[model samples]
Target: MVLTDTHTHQYYETDPVKKAELMQRCLDNGISRLFLPNVDSTSISQVMDMVDTYPDNCFPMLGLHPCDVKANWKQELETIYAAIKETKVYAIGEIGIDLYWDQTFLAEQQQAFRQQIGWAKAAKLPINIHCRNAFDEVYAILKDEHNQELRGIFHCFSGTLEQARQIIDLNFMLGIGGVVTYKNAGLDKVVEHIGLNSIVLETDSPYLTPVPYRGKPNESSYLIHVAQKIADLHQTTLETVARITTENSKIIFGI
Candidate 1:
């Protein structure tokens, strides 16, 4: 029952005691590997600290999140790019365009996304995308930039079967997370059309907590629920989902 949380953000919890307890909970729940995605330059240190504390369990990524893109996005990207060159990051991610909250920086977000994609290609790393209300924009960039050298996951995917197929066609995996367990999220229906090989599990923790703990803060320990939900949707067992998705994660993250 080895589970891998392909996407989670645990850098915000600064308390050492709380961090140790959280790591214990993850281990107890059989979540042995946790991939931490960077939000922006501000989050780099915290992410590095977490990875340092649990070198065996946690891995880090380097990127500037779409929502974090602003007038100074170029400077922010420079910081992330420098980190990518210096640090041992697993992916270039948690990056993409988000128009749901603000459309003011859409162009800037797209450039940041593509620039990061170039970095990932040059560095031979996968990407962890965070798309929200900008699938068309993201897909357009992917279509133009993707090649044999490009690969990654559509993190926290909650789209239609058509979109899922499109992502798969581009050689990217669908990152299924807590949203699949939502009462009316429609992700289960999407899952029915796609095989487990095209999917990977994530928690997006500190957000999108799975059922039975919907209102509470999400943690890596809750990944079992997401895996269970996918198992139920596919009419398969939890062990199968865990094994396949963990393998799919290794394919993407190379860990």
Candidate 2:
């Protein structure tokens, strides 16, 4: 089964040597395609460098992350817009409202989110949302602006079934990942009810590693475990899970 890691962070530089080794490990393990999300203005060059290094394997998206929104958000958005105009990014991503870590920049975050959504619409590219502890706020913005024209994936989706339905209604696919393997995580239930087509596979690497490797650093190779868990939850085979999710990814990313 060919696995597509729909989301990953191969750009963050902990150690170039170790990062290269990790990328090789993922490639060796059948992780052929990797989609990267921009963290902030500071990381755009790093993300672009990775994409340049492996243009065929790594696809990068341009956007400002919600957590990075600050008083200088206007400048950040300008930089992001300029990057979008200069590059052929696959999507406008990792942008949304997040009240989980901090709320000081709530208003700024919302404004940045809305602006990036407009940028996506104008660029004719899909969006990759990063919603956390601000579902209602995120949903409200999407509900107001989302139409048949705007579409993308809700990266690391961990919402209720009703929320899943609403996201689907907005023409976005749910990104399923390592969290689904957690015993207490309700994503298995979401998968059971929503099926595989409404979802796509991701690792969100170096963050949400699957069980057995739960507390460890995640890599694209770990996506196989995520796929296996979803297959088990849906009472299907891993090959089927891989096939359907990969197809769903191709459709969303136009790869």
Candidate 3:
């Protein structure tokens, strides 16, 4: 079965030697697709370069991540939009609110989020959101601005079942990753009630590594562990989990 990591930062590895080794490991483990989300103006070139090296296995997205949103966010967003116009990105992503880290840029984060959503709508591409500690704020924006033409995944989702339902109702998929594997994550309850079709698998790597590898730098190859955990949570075989998640990923990314 083919397993797809719908959100990953494999491109974040600057050391070419290490990056190649990690990517090969992923390919060897049947993780065929890796989608790279843009953080800001700084990482777009790096992401594009990595996709260039393995065009078939990697896809690039363009956006300004919430954490990166600052007073100069408008200029940064202009750069992101220009890049999207120049290249065919897989999606508009890694963009959303993050209140956990700092609230200094909360207003700017909301503006950037709404701006990116408009870019996604205009470009006719899906989005990959990176929300944390701002579910209510993000949901409120979505509720007001979301349209039938707007769709994407809530990457690294660790929210309640009601939130999951709201996301799905808005025609966006929930991105499930290593967080579900945490003993006290509580995502298992959400998954048990929400069907797998509303979900997609991701690693968010070089971060959020699953059990046994938690606290270490994550890689796409470790996606197997995340998938296995989901399979067990659903009482199904790994192959079934891989197949369905991959299909769900295709529906979201159109890849």
- List TM-scores for all candidates, in order: 0.99, 0.97, 0.98
In order, how many clashes per candidate?
A: 0, 0, 0
Model 3 residue runs over 4 Å out of place are: none
What lDDT tens digits, residue by residue, belong to model 1 across residues 87-128?
A: 899999889999999999998998899899988998899999
Q: Which residue pairs show backbone clashes in model 3?
A: none
lDDT over C-alpha atoms for residue 203 of model 2: 90
lDDT of 2 by residue, 125-192 (tens): 89999999999999999999977789999999988999999999899999998998988988778778
Native-to-model Cα distance after best TM-score fit, residue 237 in candidate 1, in Å: 1.2
Clashing pairs in 1: none
Q: Residue 6: error of model 2 in Å?
A: 1.4
- Cα lDDT tens digits, model 3, 1-255, are 799999998888999999999989998999989999989898999999999999999999889999999988999999988899899898998899999989999999998899889888887899889899999999999888889889999999899998999999999999998888888989877887778888889999999999879999889999999889888878999999899989988887788
On TM-score, the stronger of 1 and 3 is 1
TM-score for candidate 1, residues paired by index: 0.99
Return the top candidate by lDDT.
Answer: 1
